[model samples]
Target: MTYNKRICVFLWLVKGGISVVLEMLGHVKLALKCVTERERIERK
Candidate 1:
């Protein structure tokens, strides 16, 4: 029973880490898009 619980906890941690990484990537992509749009407007 303890071993199963440990595995479950480990899986949860890994899932959380993956989600955090994905969120960070999404934020970075959004920031990049905003910067690009600003630059394009300035070029005009």
Candidate 2:
């Protein structure tokens, strides 16, 4: 039972970590887009 519990916890942690990474990546992509837009306006 303890072994099963450990596996469950591990899987849950992995899932959570993946979601956090994905969220960070999305934010980074959004920030990059905003930066490019600002640069474009500045150049004009």
Candidate 3:
């Protein structure tokens, strides 16, 4: 029972870590898009 609990905790940590990483990636993508749009407007 203890081993099973440990495994569950480990999985939860992994899932949380993945979500944080994905959120960071999403922010980066949004920033890139904003920059691109600004450059396009400046060009015109």
- For all candidates in order, the CA lDDT equals 1.00, 1.00, 1.00
Model 2, 4-44: lDDT tens digits are 99999999999999999999999999999999999999999
Q: TM-scores, in order shown?
A: 0.90, 0.94, 0.88
Tens-digit per-residue lDDT, 1-44, candidate 3: 99999999999999999999999999999999999999999999
**lDDT for 22 (candidate 1):** 100
Question: What CA RMSD would candidate 1 show?
Answer: 0.7
Candidate 1 displacement at residue 32 in angstroms = 0.4
What lDDT would candidate 1 get against the real structure?
1.00
Of 1 and 3, the candidate ahead on TM-score is 1
Model 2 steric clash pairs: none
Tell me the lDDT of candidate 2.
Answer: 1.00
Please name the candidate that would achieve the greatest TM-score relative to the true structure. 2
Candidate 2 runs further than 4 Å off: none
> Per-residue lDDT for 1-44 in model 1, tens only?
99999999999999999999999999999999999999999999
Q: What TM-score should be assigned to candidate 2? A: 0.94
